[model samples]
Target: MASSPTELPIHRFNSFDGVELAYREMGEGRPLVLIHGYFSTAMVNWVRYGHAGKIADRGYRVIMPDLRGHGDSARPHDPAAYPHDALADDGFALIEHLGLTDYDLGGYSLGGRTAMRMLARGAKPGRAIVAGMGLDGILNTAGRGGYFRRVLTNLGSFERGTPEWLTEAFLKTVQGDPVALLNVLDTFADTPREAVEAIAMPVLIVAGKDDDDNGSAEALADLLPHGRHGVIPGNHMSAVTRPELGIAIAEFLSE
Candidate 1:
């Protein structure tokens, strides 16, 4: 029996470190694990904009996981909970837990960086999509992570209409835990240039034409042995909301 698109049930699993993590699934077919961006949950990044359904309808088992500090996943205030490459660690655990020997993986923004780390760390997916991420974003996460650290540390200090203020507003909307999120920042580690160059799998470096929040998407794609760049309609924030993002992903995967 085929599952309804709306019936996204959150499933819980214990990661390697015994911290409980959560994920949601849709459709039924080859697995496609999607990691949502920072400050956003699986629902917000993949489901809210219909990206998951769009891909799932094309015959994929869309697995969306809320990272350790975000969404329904357990948020641990203890700094020890988030070791180096924490997100990638959880991602590896998810793949192992699901017994997925053959699967597809992709992520957006922070999630995208996580995907890169996962690949560098050797979790091979049939095809990988690094959306809304660039070479600099993956190679030097502190600059971006620092921006969020500021937002989390000084929530009320931002004035209206500023980027910092907007980030705070989004954090408030999501009810993100500042303490845990700060720890998540500690999980950020720079990916080596050789590691990025060594990824042999076909990769789609999709990004919004107006989005250069991290760095140059094309440059990142150029570095990969089998990387291809796909352009979508909007900026980083707005691009995920557009149908073009999913369309690009689905098309790339189909090819």
Candidate 2:
């Protein structure tokens, strides 16, 4: 059963770099950190999707952080500033800041990529879940190239109004500075494929049947040392929104 929103506790902490990081904490057992995907905030990705409360109800202290440059965190304008290592550092700093050890970490899309980077850097979690992501950090590189081109071409339309969910999501996030989006793209470009294979911890890889952007979950599952793959029946957004995904995640972490 899902816990009510009013029952959860939300807190904010400052990262080493001075960015204010916000996280939602709930439940009363093992600690788990939930990271959001690219262009999405923790509130939208986890709270709105019912992931925070759902996971909390299963006897785990769930922490959902708003990554730097997204959500309520500080947004630096330099494109070169948002490297994967820096992102990993932020994760570690948050864990250390909270004095947490042997906790679980989970992420989706860009967040998943960051979690893998953290593992490669020796930040060990009891278990990890990487959803809507693949071994290759780049989400459909060949396709993304063209897709980004279209995004750039249709910037005017997006700026005006496009009812397409993905487009609207992108537009909603890409505001303030196009450089931040480009920085994210460049950061993903530098993600090492070997990092996925280097992760020594047990991991759950979840993907939507229609999540063509990140490749299939099976592809991601094959990269982990110990990985379990599952497919939800929806596109990327819906996959995260559905309750089954949260239940599967909580069950996997419990094991």
TM-score of each: 0.97, 0.83
lDDT of 1 at 25: 92
User: What are the per-residue Cα lDDT tens digits for candidate 2 across 1-255?
Assistant: 225665445578887666676776666789998888877777777777777777887888888887777766666778656664567778888999899977999898778877877777788898998887765553334455345546644555554444343565665664524445545554443345676677788999988888867666797788677988988877876787888788889889867
State how far residue 18 of model 2 sits from its true place (Å). 2.8
- Please, what is the whole-model Cα lDDT of each candidate in the order they appear? 0.92, 0.73
Off by over 4 Å in 1: 1-6
Relative to the true structure, candidate 2 reaches a TM of 0.83
Candidate 1 has its poorest 10 consecutive residues by lDDT at 1-10
Which parts of model 2 are misplaced by more than 4 Å? Answer: 1-10, 138-154, 158-165, 173-179, 189-191
What is candidate 1's lDDT per residue for 1-255, written digit by digit as tens?
326545677899999899999999988899999999999999999988889888988999989999998999999999999999989999999999999999999999999999999999998899999999998999999889888988888989989999999988889889999899999999998999999999999999999999999999999999999999988888888898999999899888888
lDDT, residue 158, model 2: 55
